[model samples]
Target chain A: MTEEIIIAGFGGQGVLSLGKILAYSGIMQDQEVSWMPSYGPEMRGGTANVTVILSDDRINSPVLNEFDTAIILNQQSMDKFESMVKPGGLLIYDPNGISHHPERKDIKIATIEGAKEASELNNKKTFNMVIMGAFLKIHPIVLMENVHKGLEKSLPQRHHHMIPLNEKAIKVGMKKVKVIHDYKKLVAEE
Target chain B: MEEVKLMKGNEAMAEAAIRAGVDAYFGYPITPQSEVIEYLMHEEPFKRTGMVVLQAESELAAINMVYGAAACGKKAMTSSSSPGISLKLEGISYMAGAELPCLIANVMRGGPGLGTIQPGQSDYFQAVKGGGHGDYNLIVLAPSTVQEMADFVDLGFDLAFKYRNPVMILSDGAIGQMMEKVILPEQKERLSNEEIIKHYGNWATTGKPESRESNIITSLDLKPELQEIHNQHLQNKFKTAEKNEVRYEQIQCEDADYILVAYGTSARISQKVVQLGREKGLKIGLLRPITLWPFPKKIISELADHAKGFLSVEMSAGQMVEDVLLAVEGKVPVAHFGRMGGMIASPSEVLDAVEKEINKI
Candidate 1:
């Protein structure tokens, strides 16, 4: 399956890091993956969005038109990417901030108060991990073990200590999903 | 034979420099060209084999460092894109005036100013014709593949020392960022510096205490006859460069009626276009110039005999076409297709351009 994910937020909101984790996860799943970001001045401030495309075959184009999934960590990110999300695709947003639901009926909007949950867990910074947890719970793109391996490859050597906390945040965020994509059932028809 | 792995243009260039047994590298980071520094930095080439590496404050500083190393008769190089290269032209001119041997890699980008970070081959004239002010030429090598990108690093240093001229690796974004398979040479084939000094040390400014009377490195000679004679000497060296440095790749030129002249990234895109043209039974082929200065002029001028029309494809606003006109010498009518300020010409667009020429031809 072809999956396109655009993770966007303010520069320090860990948007780039999250996109890297997703890309590494794709690589772990034996998928052809590419990650491109806004560079130069656009990267200094404002919104920093990275487009990641993972496919079973070769990726001809790295640019994304409509994302299959979008993980918006802030209000500005939600405003920037909500309309760009594909119909029936998932929108994982910070529950404490984003308010407007996309008027689209086909797509599922999972606003799981991620920042608040992370904050309640005494760690607001792990909001990215919360979003990733929601992603793991929502999509069967890869198993939790694969995501862990992806994180291991993507994280900096200095940030190895953050791994278990990220895992904990992912599990806590996964708890709120209350939904899982049944890939096995869907595979029967395809 | 060496085993080739898929590698990007920038990675290949750095790899080539390392494999070429480069003794010193002084460079500043710039878009498309930054990865060369990045690869060398992480690979810690200096620590691995006791090579010299310096990340300078500016492109000016970097080129001067290359000059210092090259003056010592050591294989040295610096890499930067267009704007950074413009900053180094002053040093390049000095190096040429002193006749110090060094290598420079220009992974060119779009610019008359700080244009864009995309690929462009507009620096053709600047590199080949000598961007620096002087009656001299730096042997410019244009590579279109990962293999050539690496191979030329060694070749550039060899040619630079052999002719006592600066050698350039004329590469662009396509080769800088794109990944291709390349077979690497056996490390045993590389030369040690003691062997290099054996070749170039005679003219190097090592020291005055033990050797000759004095070692002077300067571009100044106010005397008319003296400077005139120096200019004539440089001209002769350039003539030697012209004779020895012509390198190019020809694809299906024997039977093709139409020719596509491009290099670096534009050349890779042209390869795909040539394949499509051949599939449609259009007699189209590519002539990729591997060396821009010694410019495969003889090869291209000869191909003009069989070619019905020549289309010069570039990433700049039709800069290299002047060189094509020079080479073809009006044997066949020449047309140009290009995009400036970091825009890349797609393969389909190239095919469309070739079709437009075919319609008129």
Candidate 2:
């Protein structure tokens, strides 16, 4: 199986790290993976995006224009990536600070109030973890056990203390995600 | 110990150099490739394997440092981006002329002069044709995957010493910055002074023993006749390398009507184009030139005997296309398609170009 994903948000929103976690998890699963970041001076503060591909076989073209999934964290990313999702693909975004929501009828649209959830957890840094949990809830591409193992592998030893907290934030995201549109059902209704 | 790890291409190259027992690495950081030096610094190869890692005063100093270490028969390397590579050209020429062995990696960015910091393949001509002055050719390796980015470090060093010529790893920002899983090589022991003297004693400038005269390392020859002889020697070495080191990969080319010629990151992208084109009933193939200098001209010429046409896909405005034209020798139409100034073309866009080329045929 192959999953091509794009994770996009503000530079400081942990977008790149979120993709890294997925890539690391893929490695733990003995899968071929590639993470290509849109790197430049803009990575300091501007809109940053990364294309992560995980495949059962060798991966080709790390940089792709279309994605099976788009994890968007900001409105700018939402505006730019909403049209890039493949037909019947999934798009997950944080409702916080988002003035525009995904309106495509040909794909799945889900929301996780990552900002509010992280605020409730009293750690805004866990926002990406929360969003990751929501993505796993919608599509369990990599198992939770692999994720924990991947977190241990990716995060430094000092950050190991926060793994449980991050795990809890992911569970919170899994429980909190609301699917606003299901493309299959929409197509059925049509 | 050998282990699997996910690493960026630059970091993989640096880590591979350490594992390959590189004696020293001197470099000045540049965007898209700074991680090579940064990874080397963080790993502290000196602590791990007695390797020296230094941030030189400038690109010139870094290359000259490589020249010095290589003259002593020590495995040495340096890396930089486009503009910084331009600064090191004179030193690179001197190294080539002196018959010094070293590795130089240009993680290229778009450029005429300090162009965008994003990935680009505009340095194709600079790498394969000869960026440095004088009549010389650096063995150029174009890595498409992070694994190759790691593997080529060892291969580049081997080829450098085998030919006593400077070898270049010509990659773009895309390959340098992207991350993928790599099997870190087994750590090899660095060569000792005694080992250097034993292995390269005849040519190396190791402390001379009473048995031999002092070895001089210089590219200069005041007499034009002697200089011509030296140039001839270099040319013969290059010709030998061309016979032995031309590396490339051909995918689905047995019955393909159209073949896409590309290398490095462009090869990776064109692979997808081949898939998409095949899905649409187009007989597309890909020829990725791993050794860009001793280019796979023979294979292209052979493919030209069967294929309907060829398209050279690069991130530059048609650089490698000239090589394709030379190889095809007008046997079939050859076209160039690319996006310049750090803009990467999409698979669909590239397919469109392929179709246009096929239509023209």
Candidate 3:
């Protein structure tokens, strides 16, 4: 199986770091992975995004036009990537600062109040971890233990002290996610 | 011990140079490739391996410094993007003329000038067809994966020394910025000055003793007759390399009706196209040229006899396609598909292009 994901947000929202963690987790699980970031001036306070691929087989293209999942954090990203999701795929977003919500009926859609959860925890840096937690709750592609190992490997030794706090933030996200649309449920209703 | 890590292609190149026993690194910072020097500076290779890593005042100065260090039989390298590479062409030409051995990595961006900071493969002719001047060729290696970005550092240096010519790692920003798992080779000890004399004293400007005549390293000969001979010597050396160092990979080509030829970033993208086409029963294959200078012409010529058509995919405006056409010699229909100005073509688009050519056939 292969999971192609795009995580997009402002540069300081930990978008790239979240993708790096997921890539590291894939490595820990002995799966092939690739991480390609949209770099350049856009990285300086502008909208930044990274394309991440995790697969049971060798990955062919790191730069893809479509994705199985899109984890969007801001309205700009939502506007850009909501239409890029493959049919029967998933899209998860943070519902803060988003003026127009996703309106797709063909895929799964969910929202996690990442900013609110981070503010409640009194740590804005854990925003990405919360979002990651929400993603894992929806689709547990990787084991929790591997995610912990990935966090350890991604962060430097000095940052190890904050792993517990990040873990707490992720747990909060998993509990707080709201599923707005499910294609399978819609099909059953029809 | 072998170590595995997820690293960007540029960072892997720097770490590989350090692990390959490189004696010095002289380079100026440039976008899409500055990570090579930044990683080197952060790692402090001087402290770990006694290697010198210097940020030269300019691209010109950096390449000249490489010339100075490499003349003494030391392993030296430099890296830059398109514009910065243009600035180093004079030094590169001189190095080729003098028959010096050193590694130059060009992480290319879009350009005829300062076009864009995005990745592009437009420098194909500049690298493989003698970028600077005269009839000199650089052994150009195109790496499609992060692992090759590391492995080719050692291989480039080896080819440079073996042929007494300059070697180039021709990559683009896409591969340079992307991250993937790489199994890094073990650290190798730098050669001592005494060892240098023992290994390359025949030509290198190591200290001269009473044992033999002084070694002179120069591309200058005022006499026209001897200069022609020197040109012939360089040509013969290039011919030998073309015979012995051609490297390429063919995937699913045994019974393919169409073939896609590409290198570096374009090759990775076309590999996806190959899979996409095969799923639809199109019988497509891909040939990736690992060495751009000693291009896999012989194999391509052979493939042209059987394959109904060929599609050359690139990030340029049909540069390598010229060589593809020359190799195929009109044996089959040849088409070119690409996206310029840093825009990459998608797998579906490339598949459509090859399918169009096959339909015509």
Estimated TM-score per prediction?
Answer: 0.70, 0.99, 0.99
State fnat for each of the candidate structures.
Answer: 0.00, 0.77, 0.60
> How would you order the candidates by DockQ, starting with the best?
2, 3, 1
**Candidate 2 Cα outliers beyond 4 Å, as residue runs:** none
lDDT of 3 by residue, A141-177 (tens): 8888988999999999999999999999989989998
Better of 1 and 2 by lDDT: 2
Model 2 TM-score, all chains together:
0.99
Local lDDT at B210 for model 3: 94
Clashing pairs in model 1?
A88-A107, A95-A113, B4-B182, B4-B183, B9-B175, B10-B176, B142-B290
lDDT of 1 by residue, B1-361 (tens): 4453445668877877776778889999999789889999988887766677789999999999988887777778999999999999999999999998888998888888988887788898899888999788888888876667888888888788888888888888656765444567555233455565576666676555664566677789999899999889988988887886677888778898999998877786787788779999998989988887887888888899988889999887887888899889989989999988877776778889999988997
State the weakest 10-residue window (summed lDDT) of model 3 chain A.
Answer: A58-67
**Which portions of model 1 show Cα errors greater than 4 Å?**
A1-190, B1-7, B180-194, B209-211
Please give, for residues B98-207, the per-residue lDDT of candidate 3 as tens digits: 99999999999988799789999999999999889898999999999999999999999999989989999999999999999999989999998788767665788878
Per-prediction DockQ: 0.08, 0.86, 0.80
